[model samples]
Target: MVLSMGIKVGITDTTFARVDMASVAVKKLNEMTSKVQIIRYTVPGMKDLPVACKKLIEEQGCEIVLALGMPGGKDKDKVCAHEASQGLMMAQLMTNKHIIEVFVHEDEAKDGKELDWLAKRRAVEHAENIYYMLFDQKYLEKQAGMGLREGFEDVGPAKR
Candidate 1:
């Protein structure tokens, strides 16, 4: 449905969950149309993501995007875990130009409150805003320094 609307949709299944479900969905969609970009899942604390992403881009030429957020949990460690995940994702995005977007899913709000929806929406909006702010000037400079301007030219205009 999202793809039909011309959205370049991608799915992200964090380490806490299995990507098999999303994989099936992507496969079904691919059978219908070849428009979606299904980047592989990310595992928390896994050291191989950067290398994996690089290989994916080099081999498959796929643009990587990450989903950052926490799953529903009531443990004391939940907050810390969520923060850590977000931090790691931020670092990865900052250092990797191949990672062009981050979609944050607030699974903790699965109860489906209106406020929760609003908050989740706002979080994603803020993340996109920050990404664009950094992407336009700083990221371009880095790419320019590396003489890879053409490589990142397809990255669309930052959301206003």
Candidate 2:
């Protein structure tokens, strides 16, 4: 759980909707720890996230990246989300760094209140994760005990 003082963390988000939540969270987290510097980048939409992340690492010398974008409730948004996720993963692999992708789809909630709640919650949660990723060996140890899996969610063991 140790990082050099003033470690660089890149925070990228889309200029769409209220994705500003991510920016706010990153700033708050930065203030809380004071051990990391927050580098901010903004893109027009979800599709631009990957490039932002890549530049942050390669150009900005960031150790970790937190990307936030909100996909509206449209067919195109869903498709774009998938494409963005792919790019994000690719960037991570190419750069040999961790990218915390946090996207809250517009359709995920029943109403505006829920949507707002989801977006803010996810943004803050990922920001906190950034801290853990850079400074918490105990948290990493516990994650390892959660049963690793090949695909996305750790669905535990097969239940016949």
Candidate 3:
């Protein structure tokens, strides 16, 4: 559904997992701001996500897109991930909008419990990222150093 010239955010996710990352993001977004609207589309596989996202942007007029998915650590999964990433980038260029690709590979954690934690962590973190991207990008600029440096936390502007 096309929103009429407002802050409509699109969330496209694959059906690989039962987790609805869009709902997670929407919860976070609602807590902060009510100006933004959430539109969600669910596709079957990683390769199909870009097309859905393109439709969301071009047809539904979403201002920004957040794509979420989980790819396994197999060779086939890696190749498919690469192709999907390229298509997503192309979609971003075509729409001239930011598409935050939030993907958590299936092999990222050590076990089932850890995997669940990682998936939720990554999804929530990206949701926070979307909030910042839509509202306060200066916060994101500092968070760019989050994993790049050890113990890098945004403490806001420090006293001189």
Candidate 4:
């Protein structure tokens, strides 16, 4: 929907335990969309991210950072997942110029089966609340404008 609307989107998959295929998908999106920027991740270290993000800005001229927070497991993993997500948020906050957005999925059952419709609906509602907690229009607009200035020429209307 973002792409269709012409918004340049950059994706970061901070899925715990292992990187997922969505990272690859976002990279490919960079190729397909003139406005997209795909950032590479560096191993978490004391000073690596700040240095790496500087380079990403200097080299790729990236403006916004979106962090995807998929957990390694189910509810039992919430503590670790929350910590990881918080760490990423703190890092992004430290970077004064880049706007950060975090996406977190709802806890799933151990069996990893598809959620029933009601459960899915609740998850969607919860995710919406989470997004509100994490960001507001001012921040989003700043990120969107920065993205456009950086190289995301395709300006998309806000997603409904």
Candidate 5:
């Protein structure tokens, strides 16, 4: 159901992220369609995303949310990321809404350039996914089980 304020899409990002992923997503969404009211919330770190997202949905009337983060390479960072992910999942369950977790680990890239590239690619792709999820379920259904990856190349369907 579309709200009178338009289709409200929330984006929550972390200050710890080296790249500006939220901007990329906003640009992608803007390019894909019009009349979408994008609500953005910036947090200090990944762990703070759940509350920010929840607030966007509950308080700001957002229909869907995108939680973008960048976890460090250390083991502790991984653990923190895991915890934050759990919170995001719980928020989804509690709100009965979709919160797309877009996380890019620092170690996923070999260099700064690759990290930037991954962040932009992931943000743009996931923004498209949001469009699909909100407006084109048939398209996603047709691509089901196709091993679609956000930051990296899609693996496609498995060999039969």
Candidate 6:
């Protein structure tokens, strides 16, 4: 059954990313469930995501936010990513909501193709996560401590 009225999930992306992760995530969400109303806002860089997300949640009625970013493989970029992360956390605290951070660092991939793959995969996987957070908390609860990684393969729970 398709839901006509439901939660609004916000996507705050960065233009600094080499790949368009936001679009990939939006596609994934649409494919996964008809219950979500997706709202997107683009910023110039990772550091700008917090405000954009805050606006999406406070002004656009987003119940949860996905902050997608790609920090370059540089020392400064890494610092910026950390700052952005802190800001995202603060936003979550201030708004009393969840802001799922999906960051694919440039250094995490060895090449252009790998970077693209990582970005897209992370976005899609996180989209699935938000779906669970919104509609199926039990599913997530069941998978707790399962070592789930968004962009990479799941490392399932350790053997007893």
lDDT of 6 at 1: 80
lDDT of 4 by residue, 19-44 (tens): 34234445444444444445655434
Model 4 regions lying over 4 Å from their true place: 1-11, 14-21, 24-32, 42-61, 74-76, 98-106, 109-160
Model 1 whole-model lDDT (C-alpha atoms) = 0.41
Judge candidate 5 at residue 6 and give its lDDT: 69
**Residue pairs in steric clash, candidate 1?**
none
Which stretches of model 5 miss by more than 4 angstroms?
Answer: 1-3
> Which parts of model 3 have CA positions greater than 4 angstroms off?
1-6, 144-160
What C-alpha lDDT, on a 0 to 100 scale, does residue 55 get in candidate 3?
Answer: 93
Say which prediction, candidate 1 or candidate 2, comes out ahead on TM-score: 2
What 10-residue stretch in candidate 2 is worst by lDDT?
A: 145-154
lDDT of 5: 0.96
**Candidate 5 lDDT, 99-134, residue by residue in tens:** 999999999999999999999999999999999999
Worst 10 residues of 5 by lDDT: 1-10
- lDDT of every predicted structure (CA atoms): 0.41, 0.83, 0.78, 0.41, 0.96, 0.94
Candidate 6: C-alpha lDDT: 0.94
Report the lDDT tens digits of candidate 6 across residue range 7-113: 89999998999999999999999998888899999999999999999999999999999999999999999999999999999999999989999999999999999
Error of 5 at 46 (Å): 0.4
Instruction: Write the residue-wise lDDT of candidate 3 on 1-160 in tens digits.
Output: 8755448889899888545666776777777777787889999988998998999999888888888887888989989888989999999998898888877777766777766766666666777777888889998797663453111223554445
Q: What is the TM-score of each candidate against the true structure?
A: 0.34, 0.84, 0.83, 0.41, 0.96, 0.95
Ten consecutive residues with minimal summed lDDT in candidate 3?
145-154
Give the best candidate by TM-score.
5
Best by lDDT: 5
Q: State the lDDT at 98 in candidate 3.
A: 85
